[model samples]
Target: MTKTQARKLPGYIFLSLTALASVFPLYFMVVSATNTSRDVLNSRLLPGTALFENFSKLVAQQDVASAMWYSSLNAVGTTVLALIVCSIAGYGFEVFHSRGKDRLMAFLLLAMMIPFAATMIPLFQMFADFGLVNSSVAVILPAVATPFLVLLFRQSARSFPHEIVEAARLDGLGELSIFFRIFLPTMRSTLAAAAVITFMTAWNNFLWPKVILVNNSYQTMPMLISNLRAGYVTDYGVLMLAVLLASLPTMVLFLVLQRAFAEGITGAIK
Candidate 1:
């Protein structure tokens, strides 16, 4: 190899090893999911024929369907609402300049630094006062908009063309119309990234949902998975199946939106 190739070889090997390390657990989970609980105790990598049986058992033991439904609802709802709210707020922050606007955005960033655990009681109380405890709304409402997401949108919106907004205004398009028509379409990649992020966050959220969703029927997938692990005699096969089921959507979501997400982030970086 040339000097440059020789120098880069270690880096490439390190990256390859890191990637394999990252992927192995997921591969093991899938392999385990397809095997019997007893068979999973072995370290073999091959998939077995017990996949459906494990899943069937998981469904029988827990309200997997209801958990999935609630989780999906929370994820989708959060993604949609966050995109709508964050995009608008981002656009406004970037496009509308006034006194203290920068300070307000900075304050919002500071708000993100406050740990979620610190505000959980107050947030729960707010929901409880509204009679929304044990409801999906409680799970969805708190994270419908977040400071980090708002910052993401605002930063991404900085790359948006300002001249178009001015032209739209000149053509008598209202601010909202211009935003919906011009900004939303232009920011598809950013929106996709945010959507994936929000959906994943909601789908995988354990803390707030665990605290708020009191009723068994409304418990989310993460809670269900936790239950599987909580028992003293844990079934590895069943747990793997639950994990796979819980993981599939986020994987699918990333696969679908990865291109847009990449473009959005790279665009912002530029």
Candidate 2:
């Protein structure tokens, strides 16, 4: 073979292996979901006829519909609030760099460095004082302003053209109007990326939710999965089905928003 052809062969092999590795778990999950518990434990590789039975058991054991609705509400609420608050904070810190604002920004960044575990007790106490324990608001409030998102938005905002802001100001637009109209529209891709990240984070968050949300009624998919796994006689088929259901939202979000997400990253990096 030619030298160039030989070099390309390794790349092709590596790509194929990586693709297989990524897809293998999904394939296994599907197989497990279709098998009975005994078959799943036996590591049966083929799809079986037990999928409907397992799904029925899953639905009966957990209030699957209610859990799904609650999870969706929590995830969506947290994502929307976090996106708006963090993006605005990021934009503000970048565009309005007064000494006070800069100092506040530094403090916010420092807050991010403190471990979430360290602050859990204090945060819990504060929530208790406000009588917000076990509430969806408890989950949404704490995460509305994520430090990483603030930093990301700040970086992306640096690419915004100052000339556009000046032009908007010359047109006698209010600051809020300028932000909502000019800045937001121009940063659509950046916001889209942030939305995907924030939504995924909220959807997958386990620890804080586990701590704050006590009742089964308020439980998220992660909590449900944890409880299911902790059962004495675990059904791997049912567990796999639950996992697949839990993962659907983030997968859907990525599929829908991937183009904008990629453009945002590329634009920010450029």
Candidate 3:
């Protein structure tokens, strides 16, 4: 090999190993979905012919379709609302050029350090008082204005061109019109990244939803998976199948938006 090729070999090897490590669990989960509980517990690495049987068990045990519907509703609601609210906050923070905004932004960042567990009880109580428990609103409302998403949009907005906002204002374009028409189009990648993040988080959220959505009819995919493991003698095959199904949407979304997600995360405008 050439000298340059030799020098890069170790780095390539390390990256390959890391990639394998990342993919192994997914590989195992897929394999386990096709096998019986015994084979899964035995750590069998090969795919089996029991896929249909496991799927049947999953269907028999849970309302897979209902769970998916509720999950989709919650995820879509959270993503849409979070994008709107956080993007506006971010745009105002970066574009308005105000004095107190920086201090307020810092305070929002401080709120991120506060663990969700610390506020979960109060949130539950508030929602209960509002008679929103066991509803989709209870699941989606809490996540609509997270500090992390605001920060992300704020950082991305730093690269936005303020000259455009000024020019639009000179033309008498309303603030909402500018945001919907100009800002959103210019920041498509960032929005995609934010949507993917928010959707995935809402889809996978377990604890809050578990605590709030008491009715079985409002079950989400994660809650379905949790229920699958709740029995004393868990059906590993069915559980794996449910997990695989639950994970598919987020996986597909990430795969589709991965490039934009990377760009957005790095605060790159393009």
Model 3 global lDDT (CA atoms, 0 to 1)? 0.92
lDDT (0 to 1) per candidate:
0.89, 0.88, 0.92
Candidate whose TM-score is highest: 3
lDDT of 1 by residue, 1-270 (tens): 899999999999999999999999999998999998888887769999998899889989999888888999999998899889988898888899666889998898889889999999999999999999998888888887788778888888888889999999999999999999888898888888888889999999999999998777788889999999888899999999999999999999999999998987776666
Candidates sorted by TM-score, descending order?
A: 3, 1, 2
lDDT of 2 by residue, 4-108 (tens): 999899999999999999999889988898998899889898999998999999988887787777788888998889888887888898888689977887888
Clashing pairs for model 2 are: none
Clashing pairs in 3: none
In candidate 2, residue 180 scores what lDDT?
Answer: 87
Poorest lDDT segment (10 consecutive residues) of candidate 3: 261-270
* Local accuracy of candidate 3 as per-residue lDDT tens digits, 83-155: 9999998888888867799899899999989999999999999999999999999989999998888887887
Q: Of the candidates numbered 1 and 2, which has the greater TM-score value?
A: 1
TM-score for all models, in order of appearance: 0.95, 0.95, 0.97
Prediction RMSDs, each to the true structure: 1.4, 1.5, 1.4
